[model samples]
Target: MHWKEYIKRMPLEVKQITGPLVLGEGPHWDDRVQALYFVSIHEKTIHKYNPASGEHTKTTLDGRPGFIVPVEGALDQFLVGLEREFVVLQWDGAEGSAVKFVRKIGEVDQDATKNRINDGKADPRGRIFGGTMGDEKSPGDFAQEQGSLYRVDGNITRVADKIGISNGLAWDLSAKAMYYIDSLEQNVRRYDYDVDTGDISNMRHIFNFPKNGLDGFPDGGTIDTDGNLWIAVFNNGVVIQVSPEGKLLRQIPIPAKQVTSCTFGGPNLDILFVTTSHYMNKPGEGDPQDGCTFMVTGLGVKGHPNVNFKF
Candidate 1:
């Protein structure tokens, strides 16, 4: 609402498929395959949909594909989240899929009400980083700030010492800056990221949403071509476009109540692909559009290509 460069948008194309996904979120566009990849947390599946042809494929993975990053030279290799563990999946087209356990989570008992894998992304240098929440079975763990952010190299994974639901994660073009959101705290943070070493430090809050009668939190988000942050507003039925400096640009309204994550795709990256939820919708105040996929066209916005899994 503060930046003149941004504008409101309508959901150009809204599609509600049969998968009554528990919590539909995390959207990644695969340029090579000309498809969009996303996941539903409660259902524990990865969905592949070709935007051009509307062809959809469902892959029930071992753990939830909290997020996805392609393999550099291999059409099969993909880095994804499997519950609290991080796995490298090899998609063999018609041959089905193969998975390698890259990082194994410890036996930390999370509050069934509070612990789940939340959001993530790969650094330009190819290391994997993701946020965690109390799994669907353990939500109490996060309400108490038990879940934290994590990082993994080849074999070792480091748990961030302190933080609440590590929700949003994205990388800038240079890979030198990383954008993040601390959901419970209601703020977006930035850090000096080292692509070569996969080290993140110098944390600072760049954006903090106003408690302006909004019902939800700023969940998952991505950095745009102009370095602005496009964040999905959970429970608010909208997405907020914020400048790198944390100034509100525009509020793109949708018909859903629980908007989870968003990403920029399309040939020129002008389209914004968004995912949503209906889990916590109150009765009588519901919008049927919840749990559906909405497309935002003519955003004139472009996003950075997701970093591929180097291993």
Candidate 2:
């Protein structure tokens, strides 16, 4: 079905849950604690929101923490992708007191000064898969493609290289396919996935987003129970739902122009929690809810539980 048809069939109501963040991204919903965790990378802070009580908790980090995923079988432990390395962090106490710094697990680019880890998540087999991007320092200046995607299990291995702004990562329900996003390419690619060995192969372009049209470059995404891909279009203020065949199924409008990333959360896994950023807008200049986190309710679809990093 066309995106307009899907939007007409299922009109979604978008509501803001929090205030303006510097650059809000990386949303991870913990079903066990019934809380949603996300990050403001430019602010160096981690936020935890309890939907039932409308209670919000914020934790300060040392570096630019890009993404955070729960550790497998560990309630208080999490694997975080910091600026140049991956570290283990622990949350203590009841009210989200302080973020404890644990040991360093791995580093992304120790020698390179411009490259940093951007986005990543755990696969079905409990291994963390992530990517990096080259820093762009000036306006209209494209950063060199020095980034690469890495798989973290017992040891870190570079799986793919020559990347520009690595963003989204997701696996199909059958664990036979992997979806990845390279924002600079403005396209989504599919690869044959090996669940047992944690290997990806047979890469092919599935969707090429139009640069001049409504859809911008794809940023972050998650998969639903119906085998559909819900991807955030950066600079487009929309999250589009697409099928495995790369057909646009639904489009959700957000309040902010830089809609960074999204995930499925809430008790029933029915809530489509989204994150936005105020990258180029000043305070009170753009949309009032530009940098706030949004929750799109009544979607009638449940998302797969996020897998934890095992090693």
Candidate 3:
């Protein structure tokens, strides 16, 4: 099929799942349960939505939850990146049961009053790697760059420092390259990664967003089967796909202005689940679909299975 014909039949219409969340972010899919998991930062709640049955359930957490990933070797558990630390969450009973905090696995900072874990993902090796951002104020009155990236295996260790709004984190198919986004700098960077040791070096710029084109910065993202990075442009009202070599592919339009994050879900791993935020919109300026979880299909692409969090 021709390019235009392919685009015409792509089925870009997105179906809204749940809505009006304070700051909906971090979409993850669990193949075992056939459910989608995400977090609402300000609300401090973790949402579990079953796309097949349209059953949505949320559990309140003590602090702001940034991201959640499935736990390796344990089908009924998950690893949550909270504002101050990483904790294990166990399902109360079965697939739709409530979740409860199991234990604090690792912490980002001892102070825990300023910075919080923002976004993260598990590497191919099952170690959960995430980053922190200055939420309330800078740590010890430091600059905004005080935020840092951390790798949480059995303990939390700082991977890199001087980060601002740590967002998208993904590894290439080879597991030798890692792609990261620090929204403050407006650039997605590529780093040489040591898959076995979880070390990253040789940082280089991959793609930088235009200073004025998009309304907001880049947020969370995931890699497709083709190795293209699909990034949620916060205020641009779309998700942009870029090739590994830093070439633009296409834009997937979103109804919400502040798109927060996205991941692949559904049984076939062909559905793109998108999360949006309404905190940036005025009382009546937000779209009807704003702050809702959206599902996009017929994209002609599939996503790799999510990596489990290694203990």
Q: TM-score for every candidate vs. truth?
A: 0.83, 0.92, 0.91
- Candidate 2 C-alpha error for residue 87, in Å: 0.5
Clash pairs, candidate 3, are 126-310
lDDT of 3: 0.83
Give candidate 1's whole-model lDDT: 0.70
Q: Clash pairs of candidate 2?
A: none
Residue runs of model 1 more than 4 Å from their true location after superposition: 1-20, 92-114, 135-142, 173-175, 211-215, 282-285
The most accurate candidate by lDDT is: 2
State the lDDT at 70 in candidate 2.
83
Model 3's TM-score against the true structure: 0.91
Best by TM-score: 2
Instruction: Tell me which of candidates 1 and 3 scores higher on lDDT.
Output: 3
- Model 3, 201-259: lDDT tens digits are 99998888883355568899999878999999988899988898988788999888889
Over 4 Å off, model 2 = 1-11, 93-96, 139-142, 282-284
User: What is the alpha-carbon RMSD of candidate 1 to the true structure?
Assistant: 4.6
lDDT per residue as tens, model 1, 141-251: 235466778775665465464556677788875547888887777788888877667777899987766644455788988878788889999867888888877788878
